[model samples]
Target: MAEIISDLRQDDVEDTVPGGIAADRLRSIIERIEKLEEERKARGDDISQVFAEAKGAGFDVKAIKQLLRIRKQTTEEVEQLENLVDLYRHALGM
Candidate 1:
């Protein structure tokens, strides 16, 4: 992969576009980006399927997503946020 990228870069320098950037190089870069975007979409579909399976198993998808977000934060950050929520709830009498 590294060799392929290096070769592409080498060929790119020889075929400059109007603004000094090689047209081939620009095309290569765009193609690589497009391929990655397609892969990302496929991965997103896979994740959605997993979420559907979890829902079918009786899990609450919304709460699961919230838990996923909470797990991304530090424990101290979560505690601080929860404390703030509790304080706000108390003030609101809810």
Candidate 2:
């Protein structure tokens, strides 16, 4: 998919938006997105570092990661997930 996109020709490029936005506006939007993507990569690295440190401190990193994931969900969502897990476990005779 990426290879196909990278192979796009100059003639294949067209301003599809109504009124055809300015090139400068398009360039600015792309630059902003690139910047945010770089920041996101950095944040992901930082998160990995934190997880490594937790493991080094003799913490159960896997359980801690699960707790962090569950904390991000709403109460109703967590209940639903738990219910699904219980149902699946029971079905498998676990």
Candidate 3:
């Protein structure tokens, strides 16, 4: 991977893009990318962060973005649960 990246960097230097980047400059760019990759890896996630969130939330992501869609809780159920919570909180004079 490092060799391929170095080759690409050499090609990029030869095929200069506007500003002239020195070899050290290119190495710095590669190093920054590598550091970002390492940080991302330490967090145990891919470059995209949605997977990390899903993992943290204990989600099964086989369904893809289907999980990102919010499922509306039944209004009746929500009210009932809220009432139960209120009752519980008040029972202890909270």
Candidate 4:
């Protein structure tokens, strides 16, 4: 894949000026970024499949997502968020 890109941009690589941008280096960076983007999409799809499986097993997907979000936070942050929710609920007479 990289070889094909390099072959197509051979002219750009050869025509690079001294002290100017390096075409080959730039192409390498762009190719790496594109590869990472593809991997990220694949991982996203995998996560969606897992969530679907959880839903099929009769788990509350929304609560699972909330748990995931809370797990990423500090304990103190979770406490603070819970306190705020309680305060709002009290204010609303709930």
Prediction-by-prediction clash tally: 0, 0, 0, 0
What ranking emerges by TM-score with the best candidate at the front? 1, 4, 2, 3
lDDT per residue for candidate 4 within 1-94, as digits (tens), equals 5554445555565645664455676678899999999999999999999999999999999999999999999999999999999999999999
Candidate 1 per-residue lDDT, tens place, 1-94, comes to: 4455455556576797665566776687899999999999999999999999999999999999999999999999999999999999999999
Leading candidate by lDDT: 1
Q: Write the per-residue lDDT of candidate 2 for residues 21-94, one digit (tens) a residue.
A: 44555677799999999999999999999999999999999999899999999999999999999999999999
Can you tell me which runs of candidate 1 are displaced by over 4 Å?
1-11
Q: RMSD to native for every prediction?
A: 5.7, 8.2, 14.9, 7.5
25-59: candidate 3 lDDT, tens digit per residue = 66778899999999979776552577767767887
Query: What TM-score would candidate 2 get against the native?
Result: 0.65
Which portions of model 4 miss their true places by more than 4 Å? Answer: 1-19
TM-score list, all predictions: 0.83, 0.65, 0.30, 0.80
Q: With candidate 3 superimposed using the best TM-score fit, by how many Å does residue 28's alpha carbon deviate from the native? A: 0.5
Clash total of candidate 4? 0
Error (Å) of candidate 2 at residue 56 is: 0.7
Candidate 2, residue 12: the lDDT equals: 37
Q: Which candidate ranks first by TM-score, i.e. highest? A: 1
Which pairs in model 3 have colliding backbones? none
Q: Rank the candidates by lDDT, best first.
A: 1, 4, 2, 3
